[model samples]
Structures are given as structure tokens and as C-alpha cells.
Target: MIKAIVNVSLKAGVLDSQGKAVHHALDSLHFSGVSNVRVGKQIILELDTEDKTTAMADVTKMCEELLANTVIEDYEIELV
Candidate 1:
């Protein structure tokens, strides 16, 4: 079996409203020393196959097709 991990995040120069909200909340709570904040998502998939090449390809395709917004978001895939 192959374990796939997908990380999704907003692209640079794009505004992250959720991240800004969290940063504001943290500041309100007096959590200091934070200069910037960004938010992202992680998706884990367990595959039934053992081929790393195929698994990575499949996961990358998945990201391009549905899992990520290619225009605004970037994704990285890791297999374990």
C-alpha cells in the first residue's frame, strides 16, 4: 500500500482571508511575535498499490483535476 499526503496552500501574491482572521485572533489573544500567517490544507490518501511512480502521478492528477484550484492554489504531494 501507498500512503499519499497532499498539501494545498494559496499561491504567493494571493490574499488569504482565513489566515488573516486567525492572525488577528491570535493578536487579540495577546499571542505576540507573529509577523505573518498563512493557512493551508493537508489531505491523506491510502492507496492499494505499491508503485510510487504511479501513485504520485495519480495523486498529482487528482490535485489538478479536483483537489486544488490551480489558478490560486499550489499543491505538493508526498508518498510514504
Candidate 2:
């Protein structure tokens, strides 16, 4: 079996209002030393195959087609 972990984040130059809100909330909570913050998505998938090549290709396709908005988001995947 293969475990796929995907991380999705806004592309460069994209505005992250959610991240800003979280940052402000943290500040209000008295968290210090945080300069900038960005929010992203994490997806963990379990597959029945251990073929790295095939799994990577499938995960990449999944990311491009459904997991991320390529126009505004970037994605990376890790397999275990």
C-alpha cells in the first residue's frame, strides 16, 4: 500500500485572506514573533499500490485535476 500526502498552497502573488485572518487571530491571542503566515490544504490518500512511478503519476493527475486550482494554487506530494 502507498500513502500519499499532498500539500496545496496559493501561488505566488495570490492573495490569502484566510491566512491573514488566522494571522490576526494569532496576534490577538498574544502569539509573538510571527511575521507572515499563509494557509494551505493537506490531503492524505491511501492507495492499494506500491508502484512509485504509477502512484506519483496518479497523484499528480489528481492534484492537477481536482486537488488544486492550478491558476492560483501550487501542489506537492509525498509518498510513504
Candidate 3:
């Protein structure tokens, strides 16, 4: 079996509204020294295949197809 980890994040220059909201909330809570914030998502999948190369490819295709929005988001795939 193989474990695939997919990290999906917004591309640079894209406005991260959720991140901004979190930063604002932290400031309101008196949390100082907060510079910037970014929001992202991680997806973990357990595949039945043992081939690392094939697993990586499949996961990447999944990302390009339905997992991440290629226009505004970038994704990284890690196989373990």
C-alpha cells in the first residue's frame, strides 16, 4: 500500500480571505507579532498500489483534474 499526501494552497498574489479573517481575529484577541497568514488544505489517500511512481502520477492527475483549482491554486504531492 502507498500513502499519498496532497497539499493544496492558493497561488501567490491570490487573495486569501480566510487567512485575512483569521489574522484579524488574532489581532482582536491581542495576539501580537502576527505578520501574515495563509490558508491551505491537505488531503491524504491510501492507495492499494505499491508503486511509488505510479501512485504519484495518479495523485497528480487527480489534483489536476478535480482536487485543486489549477487557475488559482497550486498542489504538491508526496508519496510515502
lDDT of 2 by residue, 1-80 (tens): 99999999999789999999999999999998999999999999999998999999999999999999999999999999
Query: What is the lDDT ranking, best to worst?
Result: 1, 2, 3
Error of 3 at 48 (Å): 0.6
For every model shown, what is its TM-score relative to the native structure? 0.98, 0.96, 0.97
Ranking by TM-score: 1, 3, 2
Per-residue accuracy of model 1 over 15-68 as CA lDDT, tens digit each: 999999999999999999999999999999999999999999999999999999
Candidate 2, residue 18: CA error in Å?
0.7
- After TM-score superposition, the amount by which residue 9's alpha carbon in candidate 3 deviates from its true location, in angstroms, is 0.3
Q: Model 3 — which ten-residue stretch has the worst lDDT?
A: 51-60
Q: Compare the candidates by TM-score and give the number of the best one.
A: 1
Off by over 4 Å in 3: none
Clash tally for model 1: 0
Q: Output the lDDT of residue 28, model 2.
A: 100
